[model samples]
Target chain A: MISQLFFLLLTSVAIYVFAKNLAKIRRNILLGKDIQLNDNKAKRWQTMIKVAFGQSKMAVRPVPFILHLIVYVGFVLINIEVLEILIDGLFGTHRVLSFLGPVYHMAIGFFEILAFGVLVACILFLARRYILKIARFQSPELSGKPNKDAATILLVEIILMAALLTMNAADQLLQSRGAEHYINAGAFPISSWLAAPLFVSFNNDTLVLIERASWWFHIIGIFAFMNYLPFSKHFHIIMAFPNTFYSNLKAKGELNNMASVTQEVKLMLDPTTSTPEGYAPPTSFGVKDVQDLTWKNLLDAYTCTECGRCTSSCPQNITGKLLSPRKIVMDVRDRLEEVGKNIDANNGSFADDGKNLHSYISEEELWACNTCNACVEACPININPMEIIVEMRRYKVMEQSSAPTSLNNMFNNLENNQAPWQFSPMDRANWTLEG
Target chain B: MSDFRVKTMAEVAASGEEAEILFWVGCAGSFDERAQKITKAIAKILHHAGIKFAILGTEEACTGDPAKRAGNEFLFQMMAMQNITTLNMYGIKKIVTGCPHCFNTLKNEYPELGGNYEVLHHTTLINQLLQTGKLSIRGGAFKGQRITYHDSCYLGRANDIYEAPREIIEKLDAALVEMKRSRTNGLCCGAGGAQMFKDAENGKKEVNLERADDMLETQPKVVAAACPFCMTMLRDGVKHHNKEHEIEVKDLAELVANAMEL
Candidate 1:
């Protein structure tokens, strides 16, 4: 009864904290403008399955691809065991799914193998990030807390897998001894073979204590990790599915035109319609703040894994330019969090603190993009960082009127001559001669 | 040279005739001397194929690709509205252009501005003609010559058109070689996104020079491109490397035109 009461209290606290953070994140994402993405349900489903579930784009690099596949498969399959763990924790039962007999043995046996795979993958990942010091991991944007956050997630995963194996080992030993309250449950072929020697000398009572300690540690660690996701780049684990589903389905180069501006242009061009009475031009043109972007853009920010694949493939970054696509996504996410916190502090309404995305993302970084879509193509989860960069640039040019001198000249020429060049419209046909 | 009569939309309208397509002579094709050669070569191919085509002539304005890319939305909308009105007045349907920037903007973006047309890149049209036997290439000059095709970013990745230009090159009976970064993985030619209008930002190496190095690594006798912006950037990069005299940079239409001896 005491164990069940403790379990209920711990589970309640964990659920409350996790749900609160998730709700906050949802609200922050909802702060952006609405974008209708309901069309083409079939295509969106296909994209989510292929890109996020199948990990199709991640296969471009063979080494990381295989390692990521192992971790991904292991994480997904191991969660089935987590479901059993949850049942056992709630009811103070011992391997509740063991009632399925042989099928239960096979399921536990499969999860044990995957748990081993997860352990090995986490170690390899740690070595790749810290020991091997891959260039992408060492990018300037990931130097501080981002780098530590990644390492912490990996380290915590390693601990969780270790605790799982340890718990299984002790449970197996206790089961062999026919200890009370610890029945002959769970088939641990891998852990038994590996962990038998470590626990052979220990007695049944001590084995029960070891099993209980590891069980508690693993569950608490998982709960803590679940809550940590809202603050970490590992949030992609949950967001990648929705982000891939809502991805832009048009041609990669197609820019999203502002509907209000498009309507204004149409009115100006229409020969039959004149301006409405008391017409007022828009106060702002492009995305100057988080509110100016679409919900999809904000979701993209929260979904970024900060893997630096986008930055690694960016032409501007390759050529030593200021733009790093990963940083662009990260900055948007940071700004969104800042804005979310501000709203929380001000009685459910945000008071302007005079800070925007531009405070972190500089003008040089915005102008350095080639709009080549390389970053979009390289993103394993279909994150379009270039879209954010272009939106910010639209703000700079349209709202601020601070485009580069050459661009200003080009705009002037385009307004006066109907082309980017400074030449008469009649001269457009001067290159041609009669046959 | 063939006596190819290029008619303007105005001429066709006055004559009470309709054309099958409109040749959108993009800004580069109209003003840039080298790109003008590509425009003429495309016209030659269209004439040989007996395709009824008319140009917008002086009524043709920019597609607002550069302006839109450079974040000048007001200017882009203004230019797009004017061009859409002109094209609508002519009741134009199918259009083709040799510039990838113009092709991308016209095909993908113009519809949002209320201008919709069946837009095709020149290489796509040429490949279509070859497939239907509307055009034939003898390959008399380019036969067995080693040629490498550069994928323009706007044409290849943005528009997903990797095979059309390659298909055109293969029709020449030439050995088509690929750079290390070709097709969807192709790099930019450094002149996209209105980069052609200004100097490059500070960087260790110019993007075109790096891409030009990729083409040179293939060691082809001819470097072929389908976009005018790519032609200018690759030509400049080739000139920078002093390989202009050794490796000839030609458009796909030029190769097809030469193969047909037009």
Candidate 2:
């Protein structure tokens, strides 16, 4: 009863802290401008299923696709056993669902197999990151904190799966000894084959103690991981679904037109038209900071797991340009988090810190982009770092009226003669005169 | 070259004749000396295919692709409206252009501003001609050559028109050697998003030069292009490696025209 009480207290505190941090993240994402991304409900759901659920985009990288599938499927399926643990923890019962008979044995057996797979997958993943040192994982953007956050999650999963298998091993041994509290509920297909022989000599009391210790450690690790999720890239396991749902549905080439600017331009075209009532000009152009972006952009930023797929596929980055799509996304989230904390500290109002997205993403990085959809195309969950880069470029050119000299010349000629160069308009048809 | 004159929309309208399509000869197609060769090739193919196409001539203005991409929305919309007014006045319905930038702007970007038309890149139209037997090829000079098609950003990834250009190359009796980065996975010629009109920001290697390397990797004897901007960039890229004399970067229209003996 005392142990059950302690379990309940620990579970409640972990869930409460996680929920609070999640709420703060939600608030930060909502700080951006409003845009309607929910236009097509049916299409959005289908997109979520295909891109997020099916992970169709990962097909490009076959190795990571298969390895990630093992970890993803095994880790998620094994968590079904956590429900049984939760019930057992709260009610102080051992294998409470053992009444399901063969069905319970089958599930426990499958979970054991999955737990083994999860442990192996995690070890391979750690090797890919730390041992083999894959180029995508070794980028400068994932230097300190991001690298630690990812490593910590994989290591924790290995430990958790080990505890689960160890718990099964000891419990099965206790059942064989016919210990008082031991239930012959689960079929330990994995642990029995691997760990049972070594533990066969242990006494029933020692077996009971080992099972209890493993059980407690396994459940406690789960609670700790639940909280760690809110602060780690592991959050992508949850965010990918919604991010894929609210995706860019138009042709990859078609940029979203600025409707406000179109209206003003229409008015400029016809001087006879009068301004409408409740009309206001925009105070600023494009995104200078996080608040100037759309909520969807913020969601995209948070959904990114720093996988570096976008960076690797980037034309500019591949050519050794200053732009890395991964860094652009991480910078957005970092700025959003900073602004979110500032608002929280100041009682729901932001205090200007003389910093914006421009502080992290350089003008050189912004200009280096080709506006190609490679990054948008490369992202498994469709995170659009290109959109953010375009928005920042809009801010620089329109708000600051600053651009490279050659581009300024192009803009001048476009204004004067309706072409990007200093050519005569009369010469537009000169080709018709030529061979 | 055949003494066949390209008609302006005004001349066609005055003569009580209507063209089947409006040839949107973009700024580069009109003014750039090198791109003008591509312009003439497209015209010759259309003329031989018996496709009655008319140009907007002096009436047509820029499509605002560079301005919009350079982050000048106000200027972009102004230019878009300017061209839309002229196009609508002529009651133009179907359009064809050799430049992918103009094709992208007219086909994808203009409809939202009430400038609706059936827009096709010149390669798509050429494919249509071949499919319908309007245009036939006998592989003139391009026969049995290993010609690699560099998918232009605007036409390939931008508008999903990869197969048309490749099909044209195949019809010319040429083996379509593909770059490692081809079709949807194609690399840019470092000339997209208004980069054509500006100096590239500081980088270890120029994008066009890297693309040139990708082209060279295929060991292609000829690099075929569809976009006028891509032609300039690829030509410069090929020249940078001193392979300009060895590899001819010809537009698909030029290849088709040469093959058809037009």
Candidate 3:
């Protein structure tokens, strides 16, 4: 009874803290220009399933992707056992769902196999990071906190799997001795053979103590991992679903038209049209900071898994340009978090920090993008870093008239002769006369 | 070029006749020396295919792709609205373009600004011609020669027109040698997003040089392209490697026109 009370208190606090963090994240994501993404509900759901749930785009690197698939499938299937653990924790019952009889036995046996696979996959991922030192993980963009966050998520999973196997091993020992409250209901395919060596010499009371401690450790570790997600790169595991669902459905080549600028341009064309009654001039053109971007861009930033596939395939990055697409998305998230915390400190309102996104991202980096959309294509989920680049360029050109010298020349020629060059529109048909 | 006469939209409208398609000869196609060759090849194809197409002539302005991409929305809108007015006046229902930038702008960007029409990139049209038997390809000089196609960012990754260009090459009886990065994974030609108009920002190497290396690995006799900007960049890329004399860069229209029995 005492253990059950302790378990309830721990579970409640973990869930409450996670729920609070999630609300803060939701608030941060919504701190952007509002645009409706609710159109084509059927198509959005299809994308969410195919991209987030099915893990379709994760197959670019065959070896790591296959290993990732194993961990993903194992983690998800093992959660069925987590539900059983949850119920047993609350009710102070041992294998409470053992009432399902052989079905329960088969299911627990399957979960043990999965837990072992998850252990192996997590170890390989750790080896990629710390041992083999994969280039993608070693890039400068992932140098400090991001690197540690990845290892933390992997290590936590490894320890949790270890705790699960140990608990099952000790439980099997208790079951053989006919200990009280030890239900010999579920099978242990993995712990029965694999973990038995460690517990062959344990007496009944010692085995019971080991089993109880392992159970408590496993459940507490899971709750801690759940709450740790929002602060880690592992947040992508949740954010990817919403991000893919609200995808930018336009062709990658199409730059979004500014409707406010459209009305102003029409007035420029005719000079006779009266402004509409509800006409409000745009405060600023393009995006200078996080709030200036669309909600979709914010969502894309949060959904970035910090995978360097985008950086690897980028033409500018490949040629050693200053721009890394992964870094662009990361900058947005970092700025958003800073703003969110600033708001928290100031009674739910932001105080000007004398900085914006450009403070972190440079003009040189912004200009380096070819806007190739290779980054968008390479992402496991549909995160668009190019859209942010385009928006920043809009701020640079229209808001500040700050295009590079050569592009200003092109713009000048575009204005004067209606072409990107200093050529005569009158002589457009000159190509026809050429032999 | 002297044997074939091109009709303007004004002439077609004044004659009380309707052409089936409008060929948007983009700024590069109009003024750039290399792009003019691709434009002429497309003109020859349409004329011999017995398709009635007219150019907007002086009435056609820039499609504002570069302006929009460079983040000048007002300037881009002005160009778009100007061209849209001219196209709307001619009652143009369908269009074809040799430059992927203009094709992307006219097809995708113009629709939301009240300019709507069926738009086709030149390669897509040429492939359609071959597939429908409206046109047939005779391999002629290009038969069995090793050729690789360089994907234009605006056409391949931008608009998903990878297969059309490849299919046209297959019709040329040329072996299509793919670079490790081709199609959706294709590298940019350093000409996209108005990068061609400006000097590239500081980097270890020019983007075109990187793309040039992708082409060099294939060791093809010819590098076929679809977009005018890509032709200019790929030509420059090959020249940078001093392989200009050895590796020939030909636009898809040029290849089809040179290989056609007509």
Candidate 4:
């Protein structure tokens, strides 16, 4: 009872905190005007029908697709199992799942088989991510990565599941239980085999105590997963769906027009860019850094699973360009978290006067982009890499007045003759005459 | 300049003028001697069809494509407004031009600036005149010469026009061999997007060269194009690579003119 109470209390607090933080993040994104770009009416129903429920992106890569599907389906259906374990652990009630009809018993039995399939799939995933180091599956470059956190957490999840199955199978087989208690009789093969031997040593009382411990451990494991989620890289599991749903759906190069300069002055100037000459007017331009980036960009950063799928498909990256769209998202996210920590601690104090702003990204990385929409289109999770890159470019061009030297001559020619070429306006007709 | 009166499509078509088509002798047609030959041949073909038309002469300005694509939206807006005023003053309606870039800007981009008019590529107009039995080819077919058509990006992808040019090529006794990347997926001649005004990005070979190489693979005697800009670029590309002697570059109108024994 004490264990059950403790587990409930901890899980409720974790859920509450996570929900509050997610809401705050969403509110911040709305405040940044990220939601205005999406014209959701035309394709909202279609996108919801296709992307949200259809799982199309997963199908793009088949290896991870099958394994992830099994695991995800197992994860969802295991909630009922979790409830059964929680109820039994708290009240000493056996057969908590037997309240359902015979069909429900069969359904639970099928999911038990699926849970075992998930364990096997998890093993394969571990091999693919670690030993083989499948390029797409690996994480982005990290400084001082603990390395053990992922491996340890994954191994713990698998083993805890294995132990719980073993404990359930042992209780069903050796406790002299009747057939009516057979909620998962034809499922969990290896656990059933291990059950017969365990019954030979432990009596009924001992078996009951062992079963109760397994039930308690499984419930506790679930609560622990909830508590550890926000701090873990696995937080994408909770956030990715919503991020993908609200992803940018617009023409490739059509940038959302910035609000007018006069409108900003009327709204009381933000202190971030306040100047000595009264108020530093908000320039209607692109993004320069984390602060300039929209909340959707920040969400994109956090939701990235470090899949490197974008990098693999990028034409510029493949051709030896310094840009990697995936890295841009990761870097933005890492910097945001770092700066967020500073802001939280110092009551919104400046970090080294924003000198560390470009620590994660470089000017070379910014200029190398060809503004190709391939990265964004290839991203199965629906992150708009082009929007962020273009926003940064807008900042570079407008605020810094720093662009390629070639563009200088081009801009000058355009200013003089209304064309990028240095030819006289009279020469525009030369080609037609030559024809 | 005033004496070189530019007549509008409405004036020529509605008034039953001597010319059957109003040839929008684009800026290049009037100034460049080589392109002038194409416009003249087209004029002679229309004369043979007994169709009445007039050239706009120096009244036509640059179509504002270069300004629009180069991020100079304000300049584009200004140029478009100027052209609209000129076009409206002339009472023009139907336009036939040999330049795809001009055709695209007039057809697609001009409407954004509130300039709407019926614009047709010369190849389509010529093909239609021939199909309607209004024009007859004289007894001459250059049967042995193999030819390939280069799909201009503006006419192909930007405007989704591929059939009219192909129909014209088929009607002529020329073999229309396609480049490796053709039609909607056709590459730029490194001339569109206002690139003709500036040198290409460093270290990247000109897009026209890549296209020219594809043309060479076809081993056609003549490489043909519809857009004046594409003709200029492909001709330069063929010459730059020393393949000018191996293959000739001609506009589609020029080829049809030759086929008609004009």
Candidate 5:
């Protein structure tokens, strides 16, 4: 009964902390400007199912695809076992779902096999990131905390899977000895084969103690992992669904028009319409800070897994340009977090820090993008870093009037001649008659 | 070079007649020396197919694709509005262009500014002409010749047009070899997003040069491109490698015109 009380207390604290962090992230994402995404509900749901739940995009690279699939399936199936653990812990029952009989055995057997797969996959992933030193994983953007965070998540997963298998192994040994109060439960086809030797020499009492310790460690490790998600790129495990659902469904080359700018241009072009009295134009044209971006853009930043697929496929990055699309998304998320903390410290309003996205993301990086859509196509989660890059470029040109010299010349030619070249519009058809 | 007279939209309107389609002679088609051959080839194809087409002539302004891509939205709007007004005045319902940038802007971007028309890229139109029996190819000029097509970024990845150019190439009776990166996974020619106007930023290598390497890997006699920008960049890259004598860069329309022996 005392142990049940302790389990309840621990579970409650974990839930409270996780809910608090989730609320904080929600508030941070909401700080951006409003944009409607209510169109095409059916398509959005289909995209969520196919891209996020189905893991369709990850299939491009087959090796990582299969490994990631194993870990993904294991993560989802193990949560079913977590439900049973919660019930058993809270009610002081041994194998609470043993009443399900044969179905319970199938469930336990499946969970053990998946646990083994997750363990093997996580170890291989760690080697790929650390020992093999894949170029994408070792990019400049992932040097410090990002690299450590990735490694830490893999370590946690390995530990959790190990504890689960160890617990099942100990339980199987106890069941075989016909130990009292330890009901003969679960079909440990995998763990019984792989981990049974580790606990075979232990007596009944010691086996019970080992099983209880493994259970506590597994449950505690999960709680720690749950809290760690919001702080890591592993946040994609939750955010990928909504991100894929809200992905831009238009042609990949389409650029979104600024509503305020479009309205102003329409009014200017309409002969029947005139400027109304006291009508003022918008001061800024595009995104200058996190607040200037739409909610979807902010959500994209939060959803980035920092896998560098986009960067690896980027023409600019491959050609050794300064632009890494992964870094652009990371900068946005880091800046948003900073602004969120500032607002919290200053009574729900942000004080000017004289810092913005440009402080972290440079002009060189923004200008290097060819708007090729390679980054958007390569992202496993469908995160569009080009959207952020273009928005920042809009801010650079319209808000600051700070385009490069050649672009300024081109802009001038466009204004004067209606073409990017410095030639009169009258000569547009001259080539038809010329050699 | 072909003995065909091009009519202007003004002449058609003054005669109380309308053309079946407007040939949108984009800036490159008008000003660039290399792109003019593509324009003439397209005009020849239309004439041979018995399709009545008219050019906007001097009344047409730029589609402002470069301006919009280079972050000059105001300039882009001004140019787009002028062109839209002119097109709406003439009641032009169908348009065709050889440039993907102009095609993309007219078909996708101009509709939001009240400029709506059925826009088709030249390769797509040529494929249609062949399919509908409006135009037939002899294919003797390129009989069994090895050719490779470069997918333009604006047309392939942006607009999902992977088959039209390839279909046209197949009609040429040529062996269509594919580069390592082609179709949906094709690499950029490095001249997109208004990059044609500006010098390339510091990089390990030029984007065009990298793409040119991909094309050279196929080792075909001709590099076929549908976009004028792709043509310019690929031609320059071929020149950079001093392979201009060995491999020729031809627009899809030029190849089709050759196959038709027009």
Candidate 6:
């Protein structure tokens, strides 16, 4: 009774918090006005098929993607298993897989295999992050910080999974040794094999206690992952579906128009509207801070799994430019949390509150963009860097009257002669004479 | 404002009711003598076909392509509106243009300013004339000379009309060789988007040079082009590369015109 009460209380609180955050994200998305931007029914359905289920972008970086897909699908399937664990911990019976009859054993066998595969994949990913050290994936700034918490979380998941598998193996061994066979053992061969070494020494009472303890630890470990998700890069596991569903469906290259300058100033001066309400002007044009991003961009910031698939494929980044598309999304996320904390504390604005957007993202970063849709196209979770980058350009061109010097002469010639060229319209016909 | 230009295609075509097609002798064809010769060639072809047409002379201003592409929307809108009015006065709905840039702007961009017309680049009309047996090419003028077609950016990429020009070249009996980057991937002539008016970008060799180099690699004796701008750029690039003796440039109109000597 006590265990049931404890499980209920913890799960209910976590669900409430997760629901609240999800609702906030959804509300902000509805208010962002991006849904009405474009219409292409065929492309939208094709995109859903290709991106969401086919995992095309993830497949571009094959090794990690395969690992990730297995683990992701496993985590999804394990939901029922985890529920069974919790129910068994409270009431003492693994009733969740109870419907499958003989196939329940096959299901258990599949879970063990996937869990082991996930463990190997996670280890390789960690090594890739820390050892093989893909240049785009590394954070130059994370060197001084204590990253032990990340390792601890990974370690706990591995240990909890090991415990769960061990407890299953031991129970199967006891049944083989003339113990009560509660479930059929047609498919769980590896679990039974693993149990052979320990089964002879353990009594029935000891096996039942070990199984209950493992069940409790597994349930707690999964719940802890659930609570940590919104704060982690793994948040994409929850956010990706919604992000893909609600992604901007505009023609790939179309840019959103910046708010006219006069309207921006009016909103800033008007006290009644200055408090960061939905899509209001001076509310923000370019992303000077995290709060300035549209709710979709913010959701995008959170959903990046830091796969570096975007950074690796970015032409500007590969060509030695300062524009790391992954870093840009990650930076926005880091800034969001920082500002979110500030807002919670009633500090009102961002860390670099009055700074211009250009100061945050370098001029080189802006100029280096070839406007290749590759980065956006490569993102598995539908974060569009082009949309934000172009919006910033619009603000610079329209509001700041600033642009690249190379383009300056082009603009100047255009202003005076009504062309990018120096020749007059009369001279344009000169080509016809020789032709 | 009335003196500024006429207003609408109806008014423009009304002024020239005898012609079924108004040949918009885009700025290039009117003043450039060689282009004007090609325009005269197209006129002769139409005359042979008995297709009635009239040229819109000095009354035609620039199509505002150069201005609009350079982001001068206000200037572009003005010129576009004026051009529409002048064409409308001639009762010109069916039109032909010797210039691809002019053809594209008239067909694609002019509608934004309330001037819309069925405009065909000269290659399309010439090809149609040849197919219907109204126009015939002698093929004896440039016999045995291998020619590669240079697809202009506006006529090729902006609009996907690669076949008409090539079909005309093939019919002329000049051995038509293909450039590796022909068709939609065709390199710019360093002329479109008003780049012709500006000095070439520093640290970058002219765009035409790269295009010329690609054509030279095919070892064609002649570089055939659809657009007048491309003809000038390739001619200059060929000279600069010292491939002038080995290579020469001709607009499709001039090529078809040359073959029409029979």
Clashes of 5: 0
By lDDT, the better pick of 1 and 4 is 1
Interface RMSD of 4: 6.8
By DockQ thresholds, what CAPRI class is model 3? high
| Local distance difference test scores for all models | 0.88, 0.89, 0.90, 0.64, 0.89, 0.65
Instruction: Give the per-residue lDDT of model 5 (tens digit) for B110-189.
Output: 89888999999999999999999998887379888899999988898889999999998888889999998887668888
Number of clashing residue pairs, candidate 4 = 21
What DockQ does candidate 1 have relative to the true complex?
A: 0.64
Q: lDDT of candidate 5 vs native?
A: 0.89
Q: What is the iRMS for every candidate structure? A: 1.7, 1.2, 0.9, 6.8, 1.5, 8.6
- Model 5 bad stretches (over 4 Å): A266-272, A275-279
lDDT of 4 by residue, B1-262 (tens): 2112334444565676644345677655555566667766676676667666676544556665654444343445555666777776666677788787677777766664457788888888888987998865655464557788887766764566778888877777667788765664355576654556545544345557777788889898988888777878898889988988889888878877787876
RMSD of 5: 1.6
Model 2 error, position B199 (Å): 1.9
Candidate 1 local lDDT, A1-435, one digit each (tens): 798888889889989998999999999999998999989999999999999999999998888898888888988888888888889988888899888998888888888888888889989999999999988898889988998999999999989999999999999888888888887766897889877679989998889889999999998898899889999999999999999999899999788776667767777777566666886767787788887888999999999999898898777788888789999989889999999999999999989999998999897888777888888988999888888878887899988999889888888887888777888888887766823
lDDT of 3 by residue, B53-76 (tens): 999988888999999988999999
Q: What is residue A322's positional error in candidate 5, in angstroms?
A: 0.4
Ten contiguous residues minimizing lDDT sum, candidate 2 chain A: A426-435
* lDDT for each residue of candidate 2 in A158-211, tens digit (9 for 90 to 100): 999989888899999888877888877889899997888888888888888888
DockQ of 3: 0.84
TM-score of each model, paired residue for residue: 0.97, 0.97, 0.98, 0.67, 0.97, 0.65
Note the DockQ of each predicted structure: 0.64, 0.76, 0.84, 0.12, 0.68, 0.10
RMSD of 4: 8.3
At residue A354, give the lDDT of candidate 5. 96
Which scores higher on TM-score, 3 or 6? Answer: 3
DockQ, cand. 5: 0.68
Per-residue error for B195 in candidate 3, Å, reads 0.7
